[model samples]
Target: MARALLPLALVGAFLLVAPPFLDLGWQNALINILIASLFALAFNLLAGQAGLLSFGHAAYFGVGAFAALHLMARIEDGLGFPTPLLPLAGAAAGLLIGLVAGFFATMRSGVYFALVTLAIAELFHSLAPHWQGVFGGEAGLSSMRMPWGGLIFGSLIEVYYLTLAWVALSILLLWGLTRTPFGRLALALRDNEQRVRFLGYNAHVTKVIIFAISAMFSGVAGALQAISNETANYVLFASGVSAQVVLYTFVGGATIFFGPAVGAVIFTLFAYLVSDLTRSWLLYQGLIFVLVMLYAPNGLGGLIHQHLRHRGQLDWPRLARPYAQATLGSLLVASAAIFLIETLAVVFSRDYAVARRDAGGGFPTYEVFGLDWTPLSPVPWLLPLALFTAGLWLVLQARHPIGALWQRVRAGSEPGVNPS
Candidate 1:
């Protein structure tokens, strides 16, 4: 715990102090990071801890957003609701819907449970557009954040702080839950539900509670989003929203407690930085998920934990070299992929077609990676192919040394081992 303090304090300081210096676009992105991190963490509760993978978590998230919108509208109508506490509306709606949904969904485990959750979210997505009164129809809902206390609640920075406070508190609570007896039981459920049932614990009830808790927190995350944006559409209930959270959790390594948030922050920031530069940002994100799944199946958090666990036994410079090789290989592969994707996107674009037609039906030159390359040219095909081959070979080569290094550390056989 003592060792954890310094890092946590520095992180907290960065989060608190850095936003004021950022431009509006970055401030908005930071707010998004907070919300996405919270959403991933909440999903991790059910998926990671309880072994219940909810594909329709967007259901609760949408509910929370709409609920918060309704509250904001009320506050707009001169009600005395505190702006800071508006997320409770989301929390309440999420818990209520979660209990109702969990009752039926938890009856079945595995794919059936996932399908049921998917069905529930689809149900919401279907109904939200037509049910204008509650969901505000196709227009969704919109409201203004009212002033509370001396705070104006008018600026992005103000909203960022509000979101930060709520997210920090919610995460702290979720972490605390893992220390409770119920937390251990959640692990049991994840490992073997049959044994938990054999112990006479009400597995169904336990699942419902866990699901509700996950949804409630998910709702809070959604509320923060609504608060920041001041509007939401039925798109919140879309399957894409649900899928994104799943990606964040597994890609971040759901086995580690804070891994999903780690994934969330990285992906959110990635999207922020890269989305402006390329239309294939989603493709890049998917490629990243695939690569992580293939090589680092334990996820980033697992890798971090592995290093920390063996920190005292390892040689930093020696270990760092293999890690660097792996990083270099991954970057090369990613660059090759980006090059291929961008080239394809340009080649298949309508403007490219128009240009080709104007040029008498010939393949045209396209700009990519700050250089122009002709379609049907051998260079474009050869470049990524060579990159892919070299990157794969480099990665494969690094794995042997990396594995051996870790093996020696595990065996306490490495020379110059530091007892500290």
Candidate 2:
């Protein structure tokens, strides 16, 4: 606990103080990060806690958004409610909808359950556009955040603080949930529903409660999002939104409490920083997810957790060299892939094709990262191949040392074990 406090304080201080210093775009990105982090954690409650994989969690998120917007609309019409409490509408709506949805969805487990959730989200997406009265048609719902208590939320800074407070509170509440008896039951359900049922718990009801609670928080995230954007749309219910949360949770390490938040922050920042640099940003993001899933099956958080768990027994001095080698090797491979992908992206672009046509159908010189290269030339293409080869060799060389180091660590940690 003492070891955790310093880092947590630093992070909290940074979050509270950094927004004002950041540029408008960065401040806005920070807001999105906060919202995404909450969404990821909320989704993790269902996925990691109860071992329930929901593909339509976005339904609750979208419902929450629309609900908040509706409240805001009413407030605009002189409803006298405090602006900051608007997300409660979203929370209530999400809980109600989640209960109804979970009642039916939890009847089946595994893939069937996932499909039902997906179908529910799809239903929302399909119906939202046509249900103009509530959803405001295809344009969706829009609302203005009214002034309250001498604080106007017109600036990004105000919105950032609002989001930060809500997210921090929500995360703290979720973390507290893990310390309760019900939290242990959720884990038990995750491990074996039949065993939990044998232990005299209603498995279906347990699942439904977990689902609704997860959805409630998800709605809070959505409400925060609506607050930031001042609007809600059918797009909020799209499968992509649901899929993104899954990717965030699993890629961040679902087993770890804060894993999803880590993934959300990294991916959101990646998008904010990299998306403008290339049209292939989504491809890069997908590739990253694939690589993380393949190499660190438990997610990046799992790697950190493993190191921390074995810190006392592990010989860091012996591990450092191989770890450094692995790091460099991975970087080399990633750089090579980036080079190849970017080069190919530029070469295959419509502008490049037009240039080829104008040049009498010959492969012409194209710029990638400000350097011009002709596709006919082998020199530029050799760089990625060289990088890839070196990277593969280095990673292979490090593998043996890494394995040996871990083996020694494992052996050393055993009771009464002696190491020479």
Candidate 3:
């Protein structure tokens, strides 16, 4: 109970401290962090605990968003209740969709399971653009103020708080689920499907229940997004968004309860920061995903776990040199790649216009460091490009040395190094 209560205390502390210190921009970012954490937790319900990879979780999100939009519209028209009652409409819609989807999807497992979910999402995505009455025919749906206790939802801050409340509730519920019998059964199914069946349990039913729960949580996220933003678009059902949620869940370490939450915060913040600075933010995202997949399948959480396990038991001296060498080489390689890309972009765009009006002038007029500064001539770009390539080559060469050290450690040749 103490362990369970710790996060609540931390949350209370954060809420007390954060608002006074944060500007509007940071407050908005905090809201986004909460939203993403909810979304990641929803995805992790099945992906992490049940070992089910879903590619169409956005279907529920779309449904919930539309439901919330409709409910808000009704409330505005005096056909529905106050603002607080609106989430129920969204939850009901989510539950209905989850039940239907779960029935069909639980028949398959592994890759086929994901494909089924994707197909459901794709079906909805296709219909959303053409189904005029139900989905608003590509124009999507709109939401309005709920007249909360005769108070109006006028500020972004209020919306942020509303989202925070919902997110807090959702996280609490999911955490509870993780400690329940159903959660244990879901993990059991993940480890040994045949064994679960041998115990006279209907594994399919267990899967369906977990999937529905996951879908419902995802729906809540979608509903929050729609209501908070005051709009819902077909883009909410897109495969790419689903893929990103999966990526977020995996990158945070699905094994631990808080792993997805951490992943969501980091991923969303990183994306926001990178996108603000560069047009090629997607490239960076892809790079991070690939590197994480290769180097840390269990993600940041897994790495932390490993470190904690070995920290006091192992000799610090033997590990320090190789770890430093690997870390520095990795940073150099990333820097070199980014430098080369910017250099090429500058050199290749020969007739690029420098808008001095936007930059406040005197700057070289290329885009870097969130400011306009670029190479005046192709030669400048070429020089840096060549230098970066050399740096990259040198960095790549260090990989060999790192690998040799890792191999020695792995082979049990290193004294005081714990392989386990």
Q: What's the TM-score of every candidate structure? A: 0.96, 0.98, 0.83
Q: Please provide, for model 2 over 1-420, each residue's C-alpha lDDT reduced to its tens digit, 9 standing for 90 to 100.
A: 877577779989999988899999999999999999999999999999899999999999999999999999999999999988888888999999999999999999999999999999999999999998989989999999999999888998998998898999999999999989999999999999989999999999999999999999999999999999999889999999999999899889999998898899889999999999999999998998999998898998888888888888787888899889988998999999999999999888899999999999999899888998989999779999999999988999999999987888777878898754
The TM-score of candidate 2 is: 0.98
lDDT tens readout by residue for model 3, 229-324: 888878888998888888888888898777888788888898767777766678878888888889889988777665654455545676566567
Which candidate number would show the highest lDDT if scored against the true structure? 2
1 or 2, which is superior by TM-score?
2
| Candidate 1 deviant stretches above 4 angstroms | 412-420
- Give candidate 2 misplaced runs (Cα > 4 Å): 414-420
For each candidate, the alpha-carbon lDDT, in order, equals: 0.92, 0.93, 0.78
Top candidate, metric TM-score = 2
Candidate 1 backbone overlaps, count: 1
- Model 3 lowest lDDT segment of ten: 350-359
Question: For model 2, which pairs clash?
Answer: 132-137
RMSD of 1: 2.5
Clashes of 2: 1
RMSD per candidate (Å) reads 2.5, 1.2, 5.1
